[model samples]
Target: MHVRFTLQIFAVALLVSTTAARAGILRVYPGESIQAAIDAANPGDTILVEPGEYYEDAGSIYGLRITTDNLRLIGKSKNSHSHPSDKAGQMSNRVRLIANGAQETGVYVAPAGCEYKNSACAEELQGFYLRGFSVEGYPANGIQTRWVNGFQFVRNVSVNNLNNGIYPTLSANGLVRDNISYGSLDTAMWVAGSENIRVIGNELFGSVIGFEITVSNQVQASHNKIYDNTVGIGLFHPNGAGNPPLPVMENWVIEHNHIYDNNRPNDAPDGSFQADLPPGTGVLLMGVSNHVVGKNRVANNGFVGIGILGWCSATTGTDNSCETRPPISDPAANDNQISLNTLNGNGESPPGGILDFLAADLVYFQLEVTVGAGNCFKNNKPEGLTFVSSAPNGELPSDNC
Candidate 1:
């Protein structure tokens, strides 16, 4: 038998092997429409797609629109964890959802007329699972979900999506793991305005922000390889951004990840929120609170590593200062614990137009919104030729909470 048929059989066998095999199983062969299968599927049904390119029959705006809850969409992959540029000739054995220039999103997962922020949403998708596919070339987002309550994305590759690669916005109880995303105008994976989310074991690169936790709460990012982006990871709370700021960005745990060499130029549009990024930045904590950052390997970023600053004080190359437009509330970096991180070979040279004095392995700008309520750093070990660290806007945040 041909290896293709053998792989297909193996994939179907894995699908049916599940003990809780629910409802029914639908198969969409190559050249068949995924949307048709979705339309025909029930709420708890599972759909298996063959290893082929899906481009022509996609919807006008979305390549695949998933509105049903508890739906499982899986793909047959030769090797699920391999990248497209691998030397092995295995790229053709994976399911690929492609979008044309006119398309906006590759996979759009949200209920109809959903506005959970305004309480107008009728239903939120729950228990959705997607696995083992490649989504790319969409203008807006590759895999986008909003108002989703228990969703999981696993072992997927997202590439060259002009905007966000995998974006989970206004969601909760979500897990994004073992995914690869790269080459985006915006963030590779942005967990924005969401809660109870965990982003782990993903590789992100070549975007404005590799992985960002923006105005979110109770989220955690760990064991992800983030590199070659404008900023590796941004923990930001940007105020006056279209809508009212969400609840304080708090209760985050960032550790055990490798963030390095993120020196790409900022690709976000001018005057946008991320446009002011100076590049060579690793794990910036801005206007957030109650975070625990430790035990990560951050190296060779060339500008800063694990910097913590408040809203009004962190500025670079952007002439529009916070003095021009201050926030309603003091969005300071408060009550954070930065400890036990390893930094190496950072801040030999700052990026152009950035203040030369502000670059270091561990930077802390002490713009205290509330007196004595500040971040504390302790037991961080820096290693380099001359140890080009120990420079902060004030004294190192050690022993000063």
Candidate 2:
């Protein structure tokens, strides 16, 4: 009996080890191709492609496509490292989801419906982690995640001639950290309608717009070094009505960043046709509110460091329940706290101070000030800035240095 018990215990241990080993690691070799591995992946499985050139055919499928939920597409351990440039060999075999008569994003993760209706009834893809990967030369955005939730990107890098380096839309609670994103004709990081996002500790350069956050809420972009781009950070508001109401951009924390040498070569217009004037700033909040801009060092840009344009939209309400309301008929960018920042030694002086109240100083009459009020500006080391506009009309609050 004692001998039988010992044999049973050994059998259990073997079963556990086998289950862990079979969890998921589908390898895609040079000749074997990605489709073979993708076909073998179950839900929660990982597609691991080896380091080799993967020249795809036009009108072909994607490099890594995850229609099921909870899938991970990662590179091999050797390929995911921070090595010297392997421009020709390494990137040549990358997953290119070109628009070569095909209709798909490079790394496409769409909603799992109409296709997988039985075994897994289309769980909203969450925990989709793409790590240690290089995405380049795609037809659309290099890495686009549409209709996903709780996604995380770690140590991923993209370079050389793509649309948007990383485009994420209609997601929630996403995190993008420790990545190098660059060389796009359009916006580098375009995030929309994604809430609870943390964009921290990344390096971005060489794009028309370094980061573009529109109609997003509860976003905190900090500790990232952004430079050598056309526009550092472009925030926009949709004009007029009849479109879907703009979402409120609230509780945003833009801090502890080194942004410089932007607006290089010349002041060129971005995707929105607005030029990113140099000595680029660390943060630019436009028509946004309930934001805290502090601990950032903005300098050496052709334009002003932080420019705030006061505009109103009915949708700017309800990002958070604790926000105070404005008290005017016209729209105003109100209740934003700007403090503990540094701005000095930029190119265009006086007009390009570390912080410039553009809506008040330049385009006050055009802004529609409504029930919003009290935008704060204090404790800032401004090399060339002073209060030019009258204090907020008792409806708005301010503390200037």
Instruction: Identify the leading candidate in terms of lDDT.
Output: 1
How do the residues 320-371 of candidate 1 rate in per-residue lDDT, one tens digit apiece?
4566666655667778888888988777667876366777888777454453
Cα deviation at 40, candidate 2, in Å, is 2.4
Give lDDT: candidate 2, residue 296: 80
For candidate 1, the lDDT comes to: 0.79
Candidate of highest TM-score: 1
Model 2's alpha-carbon lDDT is: 0.59
Q: Worst 10-residue stretch by lDDT in candidate 2?
A: 357-366
What tens-digit string does per-residue lDDT give for candidate 2 at 1-401? 99999999999999988866767867777656565566577767888767655545446445456666667777664533433125553455343222334533456665645221122234466668787667666655667666677788876766653567777666678898887788777667777656888888888888877877766788888888778776677664433111133445577777887776566442333422333333344345555667777788766655545555454432233321123443222345666777777766443533343334331211111145343456777666753442233344622235332
Off by over 4 Å in 2: 1-22, 60-63, 77-104, 113-123, 238-248, 265-282, 311-331, 347-366, 369-372, 382-401
* N/CA/C clash count, model 1: 0
Which residue pairs of candidate 1 clash?
none
Which portions of model 1 show Cα errors greater than 4 Å?
Answer: 1-22, 56-59, 79-82, 85-91, 115-120, 240-243, 316-320, 368-372, 383-393, 399-401
